[model samples]
Target: MNFCKGKLRKLKQAFKIIYRQKSELAPTGLNDDLQADVMRRIRRLGPLKSGSNFLMLFEQFVWRLAPVAMTITLFFAIVLMNFDLIPDSEIFQLLYHESDDFSMIQFLRF
Candidate 1:
Protein backbone atom coordinates (compact mmCIF):
# COMPACT_ATOMS: atom_id res chain seq x y z
CA MET A 1 0.00 0.00 0.00
CA ASN A 2 2.88 2.48 0.76
CA PHE A 3 4.59 1.61 -2.55
CA CYS A 4 1.31 2.20 -4.37
CA LYS A 5 0.94 5.60 -2.67
CA GLY A 6 4.51 6.54 -3.66
CA LYS A 7 3.86 5.59 -7.31
CA LEU A 8 0.57 7.55 -7.31
CA ARG A 9 2.33 10.64 -5.93
CA LYS A 10 5.07 10.37 -8.61
CA LEU A 11 2.41 10.05 -11.33
CA LYS A 12 0.61 13.16 -10.04
CA GLN A 13 3.85 15.14 -10.04
CA ALA A 14 4.61 13.97 -13.62
CA PHE A 15 1.17 15.01 -14.81
CA LYS A 16 1.53 18.44 -13.15
CA ILE A 17 4.90 19.00 -14.80
CA ILE A 18 3.71 17.81 -18.24
CA TYR A 19 0.31 19.60 -18.33
CA ARG A 20 1.01 23.07 -16.96
CA GLN A 21 -1.69 25.76 -17.22
CA LYS A 22 -1.56 28.51 -19.87
CA SER A 23 -0.97 31.18 -17.18
CA GLU A 24 2.16 29.33 -16.10
CA LEU A 25 3.63 29.63 -19.64
CA ALA A 26 6.51 32.12 -20.04
CA PRO A 27 6.06 34.89 -22.67
CA THR A 28 7.75 34.26 -26.05
CA GLY A 29 7.93 36.50 -29.17
CA LEU A 30 6.89 33.58 -31.42
CA ASN A 31 3.18 34.38 -31.19
CA ASP A 32 3.70 37.95 -32.38
CA ASP A 33 5.94 36.80 -35.21
CA LEU A 34 3.41 34.19 -36.34
CA GLN A 35 0.62 36.79 -36.28
CA ALA A 36 2.73 39.22 -38.26
CA ASP A 37 3.56 36.56 -40.81
CA VAL A 38 -0.13 35.69 -41.21
CA MET A 39 -1.04 39.38 -41.64
CA ARG A 40 1.68 39.89 -44.22
CA ARG A 41 0.49 36.89 -46.25
CA ILE A 42 -3.09 38.18 -46.11
CA ARG A 43 -2.01 41.63 -47.24
CA ARG A 44 0.04 40.22 -50.08
CA LEU A 45 -2.78 37.96 -51.29
CA GLY A 46 -5.70 40.37 -51.21
CA PRO A 47 -8.10 39.23 -53.95
CA LEU A 48 -7.67 35.99 -55.82
CA LYS A 49 -9.06 35.47 -59.32
CA SER A 50 -10.46 31.96 -59.60
CA GLY A 51 -9.37 31.28 -63.19
CA SER A 52 -8.08 27.74 -62.85
CA ASN A 53 -10.18 25.92 -65.45
CA PHE A 54 -11.26 26.14 -69.09
CA LEU A 55 -14.75 27.49 -68.32
CA MET A 56 -13.38 30.07 -65.91
CA LEU A 57 -10.79 31.18 -68.46
CA PHE A 58 -13.45 31.28 -71.16
CA GLU A 59 -15.68 33.43 -68.93
CA GLN A 60 -12.83 35.83 -68.31
CA PHE A 61 -12.07 35.93 -72.02
CA VAL A 62 -15.69 36.66 -72.82
CA TRP A 63 -15.83 39.50 -70.30
CA ARG A 64 -12.63 41.03 -71.64
CA LEU A 65 -13.73 40.59 -75.28
CA ALA A 66 -17.30 41.85 -74.81
CA PRO A 67 -16.56 45.39 -75.90
CA VAL A 68 -14.64 44.29 -78.97
CA ALA A 69 -17.34 41.82 -79.88
CA MET A 70 -20.02 44.50 -79.53
CA THR A 71 -17.98 46.93 -81.62
CA ILE A 72 -17.48 44.39 -84.40
CA THR A 73 -21.16 43.48 -84.39
CA LEU A 74 -22.12 47.14 -84.57
CA PHE A 75 -19.69 47.70 -87.42
CA PHE A 76 -21.11 44.77 -89.39
CA ALA A 77 -24.65 45.94 -88.78
CA ILE A 78 -23.75 49.39 -89.96
CA VAL A 79 -22.02 48.09 -93.06
CA LEU A 80 -24.94 45.81 -93.96
CA MET A 81 -27.36 48.66 -93.32
CA ASN A 82 -25.36 51.12 -95.41
CA PHE A 83 -25.17 48.78 -98.44
CA ASP A 84 -27.83 49.65 -101.05
CA LEU A 85 -30.45 46.93 -101.18
CA ILE A 86 -31.95 47.92 -104.54
CA PRO A 87 -30.22 46.49 -107.56
CA ASP A 88 -28.30 49.17 -109.50
CA SER A 89 -28.86 49.66 -113.24
CA GLU A 90 -25.38 48.82 -114.49
CA ILE A 91 -23.90 46.03 -112.35
CA PHE A 92 -25.24 43.31 -110.06
CA GLN A 93 -23.43 42.36 -106.84
CA LEU A 94 -24.08 39.49 -104.45
CA LEU A 95 -24.63 40.79 -100.91
CA TYR A 96 -22.99 37.99 -98.90
CA HIS A 97 -20.91 35.73 -101.12
CA GLU A 98 -18.45 36.72 -103.84
CA SER A 99 -16.45 33.51 -104.07
CA ASP A 100 -16.63 30.23 -105.94
CA ASP A 101 -14.28 28.32 -103.62
CA PHE A 102 -16.14 26.22 -101.07
CA SER A 103 -13.28 26.47 -98.55
CA MET A 104 -13.23 30.28 -98.89
CA ILE A 105 -16.99 30.42 -98.32
CA GLN A 106 -16.64 28.20 -95.26
CA PHE A 107 -13.77 30.29 -93.96
CA LEU A 108 -15.76 33.49 -94.49
CA ARG A 109 -18.77 31.98 -92.75
CA PHE A 110 -16.63 30.82 -89.90
Candidate 2:
Protein backbone atom coordinates (compact mmCIF):
# COMPACT_ATOMS: atom_id res chain seq x y z
CA MET A 1 0.00 0.00 0.00
CA ASN A 2 2.88 2.46 0.76
CA PHE A 3 4.66 1.54 -2.50
CA CYS A 4 1.43 2.15 -4.43
CA LYS A 5 1.01 5.60 -2.75
CA GLY A 6 4.62 6.58 -3.66
CA LYS A 7 4.01 5.57 -7.35
CA LEU A 8 0.75 7.58 -7.46
CA ARG A 9 2.50 10.68 -6.02
CA LYS A 10 5.28 10.41 -8.68
CA LEU A 11 2.67 10.16 -11.46
CA LYS A 12 0.87 13.29 -10.23
CA GLN A 13 4.17 15.23 -10.08
CA ALA A 14 5.06 14.12 -13.64
CA PHE A 15 1.64 15.32 -14.94
CA LYS A 16 2.07 18.74 -13.24
CA ILE A 17 5.56 19.16 -14.77
CA ILE A 18 4.22 18.32 -18.24
CA TYR A 19 1.31 20.79 -17.88
CA ARG A 20 3.68 23.59 -16.72
CA GLN A 21 6.12 22.90 -19.64
CA LYS A 22 3.31 23.02 -22.20
CA SER A 23 1.93 26.31 -20.80
CA GLU A 24 5.44 27.91 -20.83
CA LEU A 25 6.05 26.89 -24.49
CA ALA A 26 2.62 28.12 -25.74
CA PRO A 27 2.57 31.41 -27.79
CA THR A 28 1.49 34.44 -25.75
CA GLY A 29 1.27 36.94 -28.65
CA LEU A 30 2.15 37.44 -32.35
CA ASN A 31 5.70 38.65 -33.17
CA ASP A 32 5.81 42.30 -34.34
CA ASP A 33 8.50 41.61 -37.03
CA LEU A 34 6.40 38.82 -38.65
CA GLN A 35 3.32 41.05 -38.75
CA ALA A 36 5.37 43.93 -40.31
CA ASP A 37 6.85 41.56 -42.97
CA VAL A 38 3.39 40.39 -44.03
CA MET A 39 2.17 44.01 -44.32
CA ARG A 40 5.31 44.91 -46.35
CA ARG A 41 4.69 42.09 -48.84
CA ILE A 42 1.04 43.17 -49.23
CA ARG A 43 2.14 46.76 -49.90
CA ARG A 44 4.64 45.58 -52.54
CA LEU A 45 1.84 43.73 -54.39
CA GLY A 46 -0.23 46.97 -54.56
CA PRO A 47 -3.85 47.24 -55.78
CA LEU A 48 -5.29 45.21 -58.66
CA LYS A 49 -4.72 46.53 -62.24
CA SER A 50 -7.44 47.37 -64.82
CA GLY A 51 -7.37 43.92 -66.51
CA SER A 52 -7.60 42.09 -63.18
CA ASN A 53 -10.40 44.36 -62.06
CA PHE A 54 -12.33 43.66 -65.28
CA LEU A 55 -11.78 39.91 -64.88
CA MET A 56 -13.07 40.06 -61.29
CA LEU A 57 -16.14 42.03 -62.46
CA PHE A 58 -16.78 39.51 -65.25
CA GLU A 59 -16.49 36.62 -62.74
CA GLN A 60 -19.07 38.27 -60.42
CA PHE A 61 -21.41 38.88 -63.39
CA VAL A 62 -21.20 35.23 -64.43
CA TRP A 63 -21.77 34.09 -60.84
CA ARG A 64 -24.92 36.24 -60.57
CA LEU A 65 -26.17 35.26 -64.08
CA ALA A 66 -25.59 31.48 -63.81
CA PRO A 67 -28.69 30.60 -61.77
CA VAL A 68 -30.95 32.81 -63.93
CA ALA A 69 -29.47 31.33 -67.11
CA MET A 70 -29.94 27.80 -65.75
CA THR A 71 -33.59 28.53 -64.82
CA ILE A 72 -34.39 29.92 -68.31
CA THR A 73 -32.65 26.96 -69.97
CA LEU A 74 -34.62 24.51 -67.77
CA PHE A 75 -37.94 26.30 -68.61
CA PHE A 76 -37.20 26.10 -72.36
CA ALA A 77 -36.27 22.41 -72.04
CA ILE A 78 -39.55 21.62 -70.25
CA VAL A 79 -41.58 23.57 -72.82
CA LEU A 80 -39.76 21.90 -75.71
CA MET A 81 -40.28 18.44 -74.20
CA ASN A 82 -44.02 19.13 -73.98
CA PHE A 83 -44.37 20.97 -77.28
CA ASP A 84 -47.59 19.15 -78.14
CA LEU A 85 -49.31 20.71 -75.08
CA ILE A 86 -48.70 24.21 -76.42
CA PRO A 87 -51.85 25.73 -77.97
CA ASP A 88 -51.73 26.07 -81.75
CA SER A 89 -51.19 29.78 -82.48
CA GLU A 90 -49.28 32.09 -84.82
CA ILE A 91 -46.13 31.69 -82.71
CA PHE A 92 -46.46 27.91 -82.67
CA GLN A 93 -47.13 27.85 -86.37
CA LEU A 94 -44.09 30.03 -87.00
CA LEU A 95 -41.91 27.81 -84.77
CA TYR A 96 -43.33 24.43 -85.92
CA HIS A 97 -44.10 25.53 -89.50
CA GLU A 98 -47.19 24.63 -91.60
CA SER A 99 -45.45 21.72 -93.34
CA ASP A 100 -47.11 18.29 -92.98
CA ASP A 101 -43.80 16.75 -91.80
CA PHE A 102 -42.64 19.38 -89.26
CA SER A 103 -39.47 18.45 -87.40
CA MET A 104 -38.21 20.15 -84.19
CA ILE A 105 -34.59 19.16 -84.91
CA GLN A 106 -34.72 20.83 -88.36
CA PHE A 107 -36.38 23.93 -86.89
CA LEU A 108 -33.68 24.15 -84.19
CA ARG A 109 -30.97 23.85 -86.86
CA PHE A 110 -32.35 26.95 -88.59
Candidate 3:
Protein backbone atom coordinates (compact mmCIF):
# COMPACT_ATOMS: atom_id res chain seq x y z
CA MET A 1 0.00 0.00 0.00
CA ASN A 2 2.76 2.38 0.85
CA PHE A 3 4.59 1.64 -2.40
CA CYS A 4 1.38 2.18 -4.37
CA LYS A 5 0.73 5.48 -2.65
CA GLY A 6 4.30 6.66 -3.26
CA LYS A 7 4.11 5.72 -6.92
CA LEU A 8 0.74 7.52 -7.29
CA ARG A 9 2.21 10.66 -5.74
CA LYS A 10 5.16 10.52 -8.10
CA LEU A 11 2.78 10.07 -11.06
CA LYS A 12 0.76 13.08 -9.98
CA GLN A 13 3.91 15.24 -9.73
CA ALA A 14 5.05 14.06 -13.17
CA PHE A 15 1.62 14.93 -14.63
CA LYS A 16 1.81 18.42 -13.09
CA ILE A 17 5.22 18.99 -14.68
CA ILE A 18 4.02 17.76 -18.08
CA TYR A 19 0.93 19.99 -17.89
CA ARG A 20 3.12 23.01 -17.07
CA GLN A 21 5.34 22.27 -20.09
CA LYS A 22 2.25 21.95 -22.37
CA SER A 23 0.82 25.28 -21.14
CA GLU A 24 4.18 26.97 -21.70
CA LEU A 25 4.31 25.60 -25.26
CA ALA A 26 0.81 26.88 -26.12
CA PRO A 27 0.68 29.54 -28.87
CA THR A 28 0.45 33.17 -27.73
CA GLY A 29 -1.71 35.92 -29.35
CA LEU A 30 0.68 36.91 -32.19
CA ASN A 31 1.51 33.24 -33.07
CA ASP A 32 -2.19 32.31 -33.19
CA ASP A 33 -2.95 35.19 -35.58
CA LEU A 34 -0.03 34.13 -37.82
CA GLN A 35 -1.25 30.48 -37.83
CA ALA A 36 -4.79 31.59 -38.80
CA ASP A 37 -3.34 33.54 -41.72
CA VAL A 38 -1.51 30.39 -42.91
CA MET A 39 -4.70 28.31 -42.71
CA ARG A 40 -6.57 30.82 -44.93
CA ARG A 41 -4.27 29.81 -47.89
CA ILE A 42 -5.76 26.22 -47.88
CA ARG A 43 -8.62 25.46 -50.36
CA ARG A 44 -11.67 23.15 -50.12
CA LEU A 45 -12.39 21.21 -53.36
CA GLY A 46 -15.37 18.90 -52.75
CA PRO A 47 -18.29 18.34 -50.39
CA LEU A 48 -18.56 15.20 -48.20
CA LYS A 49 -20.77 12.29 -49.39
CA SER A 50 -23.94 12.61 -47.25
CA GLY A 51 -25.27 9.06 -47.73
CA SER A 52 -22.06 7.37 -46.59
CA ASN A 53 -21.67 9.83 -43.73
CA PHE A 54 -25.21 9.11 -42.45
CA LEU A 55 -24.71 5.33 -42.71
CA MET A 56 -21.35 5.44 -40.88
CA LEU A 57 -22.75 7.67 -38.14
CA PHE A 58 -25.82 5.47 -37.65
CA GLU A 59 -23.68 2.31 -37.46
CA GLN A 60 -21.29 3.91 -34.95
CA PHE A 61 -24.22 5.02 -32.76
CA VAL A 62 -25.74 1.51 -32.79
CA TRP A 63 -22.36 -0.11 -31.99
CA ARG A 64 -21.93 2.14 -28.95
CA LEU A 65 -25.56 1.90 -27.66
CA ALA A 66 -26.22 -1.84 -28.30
CA PRO A 67 -24.30 -3.03 -25.25
CA VAL A 68 -26.05 -0.49 -22.98
CA ALA A 69 -29.47 -1.51 -24.30
CA MET A 70 -28.71 -5.22 -23.87
CA THR A 71 -27.48 -4.64 -20.32
CA ILE A 72 -30.65 -2.72 -19.35
CA THR A 73 -32.85 -5.43 -20.87
CA LEU A 74 -30.96 -8.17 -19.09
CA PHE A 75 -31.20 -6.34 -15.76
CA PHE A 76 -34.95 -5.84 -16.09
CA ALA A 77 -35.47 -9.45 -17.15
CA ILE A 78 -33.51 -10.76 -14.17
CA VAL A 79 -35.25 -8.51 -11.68
CA LEU A 80 -38.67 -9.29 -13.07
CA MET A 81 -38.24 -13.06 -13.14
CA ASN A 82 -36.54 -13.66 -9.78
CA PHE A 83 -39.03 -12.44 -7.21
CA ASP A 84 -37.47 -14.33 -4.29
CA LEU A 85 -34.30 -12.24 -4.51
CA ILE A 86 -36.28 -9.42 -2.93
CA PRO A 87 -37.05 -9.43 0.79
CA ASP A 88 -40.44 -10.87 1.68
CA SER A 89 -42.10 -7.53 2.39
CA GLU A 90 -45.28 -5.95 1.04
CA ILE A 91 -43.91 -2.49 0.16
CA PHE A 92 -40.74 -3.74 -1.62
CA GLN A 93 -42.69 -6.33 -3.60
CA LEU A 94 -45.26 -3.73 -4.63
CA LEU A 95 -42.54 -1.35 -5.75
CA TYR A 96 -40.87 -3.98 -7.97
CA HIS A 97 -44.07 -5.63 -9.25
CA GLU A 98 -44.06 -6.24 -13.01
CA SER A 99 -46.67 -4.92 -15.43
CA ASP A 100 -49.03 -7.37 -17.10
CA ASP A 101 -47.50 -7.09 -20.55
CA PHE A 102 -43.91 -7.45 -19.27
CA SER A 103 -44.37 -9.60 -16.17
CA MET A 104 -42.51 -12.66 -14.89
CA ILE A 105 -44.99 -14.92 -16.72
CA GLN A 106 -43.91 -13.56 -20.09
CA PHE A 107 -40.24 -13.68 -19.04
CA LEU A 108 -40.43 -17.34 -17.94
CA ARG A 109 -41.86 -18.33 -21.35
CA PHE A 110 -38.54 -17.36 -22.89
Candidate 4:
Protein backbone atom coordinates (compact mmCIF):
# COMPACT_ATOMS: atom_id res chain seq x y z
CA MET A 1 0.00 0.00 0.00
CA ASN A 2 1.05 3.58 -0.51
CA PHE A 3 0.80 4.24 3.24
CA CYS A 4 3.25 1.43 4.05
CA LYS A 5 5.62 2.63 1.30
CA GLY A 6 5.53 6.16 2.77
CA LYS A 7 6.33 4.84 6.27
CA LEU A 8 9.19 2.70 4.90
CA ARG A 9 10.63 5.67 3.03
CA LYS A 10 10.43 7.79 6.17
CA LEU A 11 12.15 4.98 8.24
CA LYS A 12 14.92 4.66 5.63
CA GLN A 13 15.47 8.42 5.61
CA ALA A 14 15.62 8.46 9.44
CA PHE A 15 18.17 5.61 9.47
CA LYS A 16 20.26 7.35 6.78
CA ILE A 17 20.26 10.58 8.80
CA ILE A 18 21.22 8.68 11.97
CA TYR A 19 24.05 6.60 10.43
CA ARG A 20 25.47 8.99 7.82
CA GLN A 21 29.27 9.37 8.24
CA LYS A 22 31.36 12.49 7.49
CA SER A 23 35.14 12.76 7.12
CA GLU A 24 36.43 15.99 8.67
CA LEU A 25 39.66 17.17 10.30
CA ALA A 26 37.93 19.48 12.84
CA PRO A 27 35.56 18.31 15.58
CA THR A 28 31.78 18.68 15.02
CA GLY A 29 30.66 19.80 18.53
CA LEU A 30 31.29 19.46 22.28
CA ASN A 31 30.56 15.72 22.17
CA ASP A 32 33.20 15.09 19.48
CA ASP A 33 35.31 12.96 21.90
CA LEU A 34 32.35 10.71 22.88
CA GLN A 35 33.41 7.99 20.40
CA ALA A 36 36.97 8.10 21.75
CA ASP A 37 35.69 7.86 25.33
CA VAL A 38 33.53 4.83 24.45
CA MET A 39 36.47 3.12 22.76
CA ARG A 40 38.70 3.79 25.78
CA ARG A 41 36.13 2.30 28.13
CA ILE A 42 35.77 -0.81 25.94
CA ARG A 43 39.58 -1.23 25.79
CA ARG A 44 39.79 -1.04 29.59
CA LEU A 45 38.03 -4.39 29.74
CA GLY A 46 40.81 -6.86 28.75
CA PRO A 47 38.93 -9.38 26.60
CA LEU A 48 35.44 -10.71 25.96
CA LYS A 49 34.54 -14.11 27.38
CA SER A 50 34.91 -16.59 24.53
CA GLY A 51 33.50 -20.10 23.97
CA SER A 52 36.57 -21.67 25.63
CA ASN A 53 35.78 -19.82 28.86
CA PHE A 54 32.18 -21.00 28.61
CA LEU A 55 33.39 -24.61 28.15
CA MET A 56 35.62 -24.27 31.20
CA LEU A 57 32.66 -22.98 33.23
CA PHE A 58 30.58 -25.95 32.07
CA GLU A 59 33.41 -28.33 32.95
CA GLN A 60 33.51 -26.90 36.47
CA PHE A 61 29.78 -27.61 36.97
CA VAL A 62 29.75 -31.02 35.22
CA TRP A 63 30.93 -32.91 38.31
CA ARG A 64 28.06 -31.48 40.37
CA LEU A 65 25.49 -32.23 37.59
CA ALA A 66 26.54 -35.87 37.00
CA PRO A 67 25.08 -37.29 40.22
CA VAL A 68 21.64 -35.69 39.61
CA ALA A 69 21.57 -36.99 36.02
CA MET A 70 22.54 -40.50 37.14
CA THR A 71 19.91 -40.47 39.89
CA ILE A 72 17.13 -39.53 37.42
CA THR A 73 18.24 -42.23 34.97
CA LEU A 74 18.29 -44.91 37.67
CA PHE A 75 14.86 -43.86 38.97
CA PHE A 76 13.39 -44.08 35.46
CA ALA A 77 14.96 -47.49 34.90
CA ILE A 78 13.51 -48.78 38.19
CA VAL A 79 9.97 -47.53 37.29
CA LEU A 80 10.12 -49.17 33.83
CA MET A 81 11.38 -52.43 35.33
CA ASN A 82 8.52 -52.53 37.89
CA PHE A 83 5.70 -52.40 35.30
CA ASP A 84 4.61 -54.50 32.31
CA LEU A 85 4.68 -51.97 29.41
CA ILE A 86 2.10 -53.87 27.33
CA PRO A 87 -0.91 -52.08 25.87
CA ASP A 88 -3.50 -54.73 26.62
CA SER A 89 -3.61 -56.63 29.92
CA GLU A 90 -5.77 -59.38 28.38
CA ILE A 91 -3.16 -60.15 25.71
CA PHE A 92 -0.43 -60.05 28.35
CA GLN A 93 -2.32 -62.52 30.57
CA LEU A 94 -3.10 -64.84 27.63
CA LEU A 95 0.53 -64.90 26.62
CA TYR A 96 2.07 -65.23 30.13
CA HIS A 97 -0.54 -67.14 32.25
CA GLU A 98 -2.21 -70.53 31.68
CA SER A 99 -6.02 -70.28 31.31
CA ASP A 100 -8.63 -73.02 31.47
CA ASP A 101 -11.37 -71.21 29.54
CA PHE A 102 -12.07 -73.18 26.35
CA SER A 103 -14.62 -70.56 25.21
CA MET A 104 -11.94 -67.79 25.28
CA ILE A 105 -9.59 -69.93 23.17
CA GLN A 106 -12.43 -70.59 20.71
CA PHE A 107 -13.19 -66.92 20.54
CA LEU A 108 -9.51 -66.18 19.79
CA ARG A 109 -9.58 -68.83 17.04
CA PHE A 110 -12.74 -67.29 15.54
- The best candidate by TM-score is 2
- Which residue pairs does candidate 2 place in steric collision? none
lDDT of all predictions, in order shown?
A: 0.71, 0.82, 0.73, 0.74
RMSD per candidate (Å) reads 19.5, 12.1, 14.5, 12.4
Candidate 3 vs 4: which has more TM-score: 4
Expressed as tens digits, the lDDT of each residue in 1-110 for candidate 3 is 35698899999999999999998987655687677776665424234576579999999999999999999999999988986554436534554674533655544554
Residue-level lDDT tens digits of model 1 in 38-109: 989988877555434667889899999999999999999999999865544212233235535334345445
Which residue pairs in model 4 clash with each other?
none
Q: Write the per-residue lDDT of candidate 4 for residues 1-110, one digit (tens) a residue.
A: 45698899999998877666433545666574887888888888757788569888899799889999999999999999997664557665765665564445654674
Task: Quote the positional error of residue 89 for candidate 3 in Å.
Answer: 24
Ranking by lDDT: 2, 4, 3, 1
Among all candidates shown, the one with the greatest lDDT? 2
Deviating ranges (above 4 Å) for candidate 1 = 1-52, 87-110
Provide the lDDT at 15 for model 4: 81
Off by over 4 Å in 3: 1-48, 83-110
TM-scores of all predicted structures: 0.31, 0.39, 0.32, 0.34
Error of 1 at 12 (Å): 64
